[model samples]
Every structure is written in structure tokens, then in C-alpha cells.
Target: MNQKLKKQDWTVRVLQELERQYSPSRWSHRMSADDVIKAHVKALKEGTEQARDLAQTLLNVPYGEGDGEKLDVYIPKTNSLDVHLVVYLHGGYWQFLSKEESGFMAVPLIDKGVVVVAVGYDIAPKGNMDLMVSQVRRSVVSVVQQYSHISGLYLCGHSAGAHLAAMVLSTDWSQYSITPQIKGAFLVSGIYDLLPILSTYVMEPLKMTEEVAVRNSPSKLVPQLKLSSSSCQIVVAVAENDSPEFRKQSEEYYKALEESGLSVTMEDVANTDHFNIIEQLVDGEYHLTKVHR
Candidate 1:
């Protein structure tokens, strides 16, 4: 084949590999995709109950006018210092999950004298990427405003939620009349770029266009940080069993931030897949939680 044809063929193969790598069904031997999802929901339900019994919690506080624009706040019973806040956004490819599944990580953080906020936003088909992004932004601002005594804010997200968390890092805080009080962010198994996802089977319901994909990609949207000190505080992490594309995306995002003079750390989480990596947060000693602390 001619060199031109060879290059075109290679591009097609690369795209195919990306789709295969990202499709959770392809990795179902370890656990079925359906089971992985069920595990999350089960953990969330258990955690929600535990959160109520273990800590003082406020449920379904509205942050926006939308039906899903609400958050669950978990507060520790005992604390000697000004408590900080850790806001979690759950992932379901921006379509499948809810804030109800977000409380699984709350008990551990709350135990450390940190307030945990699990945010809810409308998912896809019913809600677009723009709407989800906006709701999360509004939720963050609302949380900060609601709790005036917070020492700082930390953002944690998994998968698509990680994408949204990265978007939060790029936010123009001036627009909301709020200072960027976010002290750090832990982005786990996230999709930083949506371009590859658009070509994958998952995008059918997301109905993403090239324009939307490019515009919302966190890898492509790293903002100029106002302070040098604030840049390095973000942590970018990927799991041992995460697909090659997922790991690559995380590395690429970390490089982009570093090259832009932003302070970012890249971590390889061992002995876990995409699903269990976030679940690790349920255990306080898990490296994922350590990163946040």
C-alpha cells in the first residue's frame, strides 16, 4: 500500500483500539459491566444509611432550580478545628448515575472532620453536557456560600464526574462572583478528552457533536491559573486495570497542566479496576483518600 493509504489505515485501527479499550463490556471477565454498576449502587445505598447513622447529614439541599440540582451534606460529630469541605460528583458517563450513589465516600472524609457534599445533576438524554457542567459549578458555589466557616474546598470525582471536576478547575470564578476557594482536587479514572468518546458507542445517548466534544474536553480546556501556588495542588490518578486509553488520557492531562506551569501530580493506583478504584475511597487508608488528605 502507498504511504498515504498506510497512514489512513493506521488511524482507523487506532480509533478502533480506543473504542475497545474504553468499552467496559470488553473487560467483563473480572466483573460484568452490569455488576460493576450494581456494586456502586449497592455501596451507595449502604453508605447513605451509614452516613445518616454515623454522622449528621443534610439530605437533598437544592442548589439550582432543576430537579436533580441538589446535594447531600455529611458532617462529622466531633471536630477540633475549622472543618474543610470535600465535594464529590459521581460518574455514569454523565448519563447513568445520581447523587444518591455519591455518599459511599462520605463517611471516611467526615470521620476526619471534613464535611462531605454529594452533588446531583441531571444526566444525559434528559440533560446535556452544558447543563451538567453548569449545575456542578452552581453546586460548588452554593456549597461554599452555604457553609461560610469552611477552611477550604476539595473536589473529588470518578470517571465522567472526574471530567466535570477538571472542568471546575478551569472555571472562571469571577463569573459567579466567587473566589476560587478550592484547595485541591482528586480526579480518579476520568475522561479528560471527549473527542475519543464521541467516536465510541457510548456517545450515541450523549449525542455529542464535534463542537461539543472539543468545547467540554478537560484535557483541551485547562485554564490559566491566577496563582502559581494553586496550580500544583491538583492530583490526576488512574487505576492499574484502567484501559490504556484511560491511562493515556490521564497522563496527557497531567502533562498539559505541567507544561502550562500548573502544579499537578500523576498517580498510578495499583490492584484495582476502573470501578473499584473509586470504591477505594470507602476505606480511609486507601491511597485515593490519602491523596485528598
Candidate 2:
């Protein structure tokens, strides 16, 4: 085969394999993709609403100049001299979900005196890969700046949001005025490599090229993470029922971080799939929530 033909053949095989591995809904025995999403959205809505009433919330706070560059802050009812802030990034394959429905996890955390901030960034068809990454980085910077006296800073993200959180860990803080004192990170069922996504149906709205995928992939940025976030403890968690590919990616990324001498651990949450693995964050007694506490 010619060079072009060889490339075409490789792409075809990759597409087929990746489509099966990346289709998280197919591996889910509990519910169909639609049902899972509906439940996920309902949990987010109810949890966020409940959290609003329970906490001292500052909603729609802008972190950047962009329209979508805003975050919702949830402060605990009982003020404490020492406060730990957790910034959450929601996952909708980078095309859906917003801060409004992202505060569900805050419900349980606020009761423990943890302040939660749900971050917002422009999703696909409106924002490109580079722009979203930049916006998230700026959001963290803004958080550190706004809360200068915070005792510690943490990051939590799910699925695509996990990818974004990993990217944040690999950021070059010298470019920004402030280097966030990140204490730890929770990455749940995330897609660390974007190359496989480029060939999947999820690529339609994001419109990422090979170069974009390569640059944005958290797996490829592990070296930078070693330099920038070596002190930050990272927990890379995946649902037991997640697609094999998701587990593989998490394992590989954890290995990479460990090899680079960064503080990282891998968690395989039992009896859960992609959606509920994170949705259960609303429950204070949940396994992951306990881990957070």
C-alpha cells in the first residue's frame, strides 16, 4: 500500500476498536445511555438545588472575561478559620453539562466544612480544545487569587472533566502570576488520551485535529505534571464496570505519573459504572465521598 493507503487502513482499524472501547454505555448493564444521562442530570439538579439551600453560595461568579468563564461557589454554613476549597469540573464529553447542574457533590462536602466551586467553560461548537484548556487554567488561577488565604486547594473532575483536571496539573504556572497551592486531585472515569476520541462520534462537535489531540492529551503531558504538580496527591479512579479502555487509560496514566515520581494512586471503585460512580458523590457515606473526606 502507498503511504496514504497505509494511514487510511490504520485509521479504520483504530476507529473500530476505539468505538467499542470508548462506548461506556454499552458496558453498562444497569441502564441504557439515555437513561443513565437522565438519571445523571436529575441527580445533578436535585443535588445542586439542595446544596444551594444548605450552603452560603455565590452563584455565577466570573473567573474570566468569557461568557462561559464563570463558577458557582458553595461555602459551608458554619464558618471555619481553616478552609479547603475543591474546584469541580463537570463532564458531558465536553459538549454538555454546566455549572448549574455540577454542584451536587457540594451538598455533602459543604456539611464537612469544605467549600466547593463548580467551574464552567465553553463546551463544543462554541469553544475549541485549546480555549477550554486555557479557560480552565485561568479559572484555577482566579480561584487562588480570590481566596488568597485558603488552607488548601483541591481539584475534582469526571470523564472529560477529568481530562481537563489532568491538564491543569500539567500547567506551566510560570506563565501565570500565581501558582496555585494544589493539595490533591480526584480524577474519576476520565478520558486521558484524546487521540482515540478524534476518531469517535464524540469528535463531531469538538472538531479536534491530530495535532490538537496530541497536545491536549494528559497522558502525553505527564512530564510537565512531574515538574509542576509533583507535590500534589492525585487519585485516578475508575468505575469497576467502566469500559475496558477507560480502565486501561487510568492504569497507564497512573503508571506514567508514578514513573515520573509524582504522588499518584489508582482506585477501582466497585459495583459502579461511569455515571453513578460520580453521581454517588451526592451521598456523604458513599465510598468516594468518604475517600474525599
Candidate 3:
């Protein structure tokens, strides 16, 4: 394999081992119930709320009804926004965290008078990748429908969330008949390939077969979007202190998108880790300002 591909494979392996240790499935094996799915969801929800509660004074907004895929809005009460709706997708390797966890990151953007929606979704094992993605899709549709005045839809997602955000914007809106355009997408340390993550610990929850992995990966799908989308902005970001796997995907996907003639911007931030990198978006000290270009 070439140096780039070899590097990609090694990084994927490292994430797999880390995921194996932290995946909720590891906790499920000990629960020993036919419907351990609920148990897993409950635990993840508790953890997600704890993360959200860490931030003081967050407004819980139901993008959909009755806590069904709710998005937490953490903006200022001043109520001034004329730009795109900045929807943030939180990353827990697609199994943990929620809108609550991401609200902390949105605090600054919220304060910036930008409409920030931290989308929460069901995780894997209980539902699988398709269901997880479906929840986000539904949330976006609801946001546009419910908030009709919003002119544009922009996305920001970290890690696995970043991957999903990329997919959402890469969507062919013409096929969906959605009127509001997807203005731009910001993918912070997202994963775009799964070959390296397969067969490792993360796979149990992801249940990512080779076929599904290839189909979902943005690296594979971005090339096929030119027919439907030609003028979308994509910003692929990485922190200087992020894992090798994160850096690998951020840089690789950035290059791929740039090569495809998309307006792609890649940012490498200093002194930031994976979890805190999203903070830079709201803080303005981070590269998200660069990403907006």
C-alpha cells in the first residue's frame, strides 16, 4: 500500500482498539438481557444528560415533539439571527453523548446570535447506523419545517457526528424537494473510512459490514455528488492534539473534497484535543472562523 493508505490503516486500527474499550456494547455484555438495547440507551441517556447539565442555563428545544430526537438550543436569549441554522452533531463514536453534551460547545455560537441546534439521536446496537442517521435526517427536516424563516442550513459535527453531518450536506436536495439550501458543512475530526475500524472493538456496536461501511463513507460518496451538487462549502477540521485516527480522516477527507472541486477548507488547530476542539467553534479562537471561509 502507498504511504497514505498504510497510514490510514494504522490509524483505523488504533481507533478500533480504543472503541472496543469504551463502546457501550462492552457494558451490555455484562447486563445479560434479551433487550439490553433499552439498558444501553438508558445508560447513554444518563451520561448524555450529565454532559448537558455540565453547562449552566441551557434551553431545551424540542425540534420534534415530546423529546423524540430533541435538539438543545444554547444561544443567547437576545433572539437575533439572520444566517444559516448551525446544527451541531455530537460525536460519541456514534453510540454515546447527546444534544446535551454538544450544547456546551454551542454556548459560544449561541451567544454569537447564530441559531445553533445540537441534534441528539439514537445510537448503534439498539438500532444500527441507518437508524442513527435517520434520526438526524428527521431532525433536520423538522427544523426546516418548524422554523420556516431560516434561509440556510449549515452543519457542524465532531468525530462520528462530523461524518454524519458530511453525509447530510452531501445529500441531493433536489431529490428530496427541500427548499432551503444546505449552505455549508463543517466536519471536525470525522471518520470517512471504516476498513481499519472493522473487525475491531468498535464494530460490535456499529455492526458495520463491509458493504454498509463503503456505502456510508463520505470519501466514497463525495465523488458521486457532482451531478446534483456543485456549489457546497465543506470545511474539514482537525486539532493538533487529536488522535492519529482523527487527524488521518480530517486531512484525507479535506484533500478528497478539495480535489473534487468543492470549496474545501482544512484547519489544523493548536493545543486542542478531540473533545474540546468543538469548543473552538464558539470561542472564535479556534479554526472554525477559518472554516467559515
Best by TM-score: 2
Per-residue lDDT over 179-236 for candidate 2, one digit per residue giving the tens place of the 0 to 100 score: 8879999999998988878778889999999999999999999988888898999999
Question: Cα deviation of 148 in candidate 3 (Å)?
Answer: 1.9
All models: lDDT? Answer: 0.82, 0.91, 0.66
Residue 238 CA error for candidate 2 (Å)?
0.2
Task: Give one digit per residue, the lDDT tens place, for model 3 in 13-67.
Answer: 8776766433323323334433543543454455445434443333565654534
> Could you arrange the candidates by TM-score from highest to lowest?
2, 1, 3
lDDT of 2 at 289: 92
Give candidate 2 regions above 4 Å deviation: 1-14
Which 10 residues in a row give candidate 3 its minimum summed lDDT? 21-30
TM-score of 1: 0.90
> Which regions of candidate 3 deviate over 4 angstroms?
1-68, 78-83, 174-179, 227-229, 289-293
Q: Which residue pairs come into collision in candidate 2?
A: none
On the 0 to 100 scale, the lDDT of residue 149 in model 1 is 85
Where does candidate 2 have its weakest 10-residue lDDT segment?
20-29
Give candidate 3's root-mean-square deviation (CA, Å): 8.3
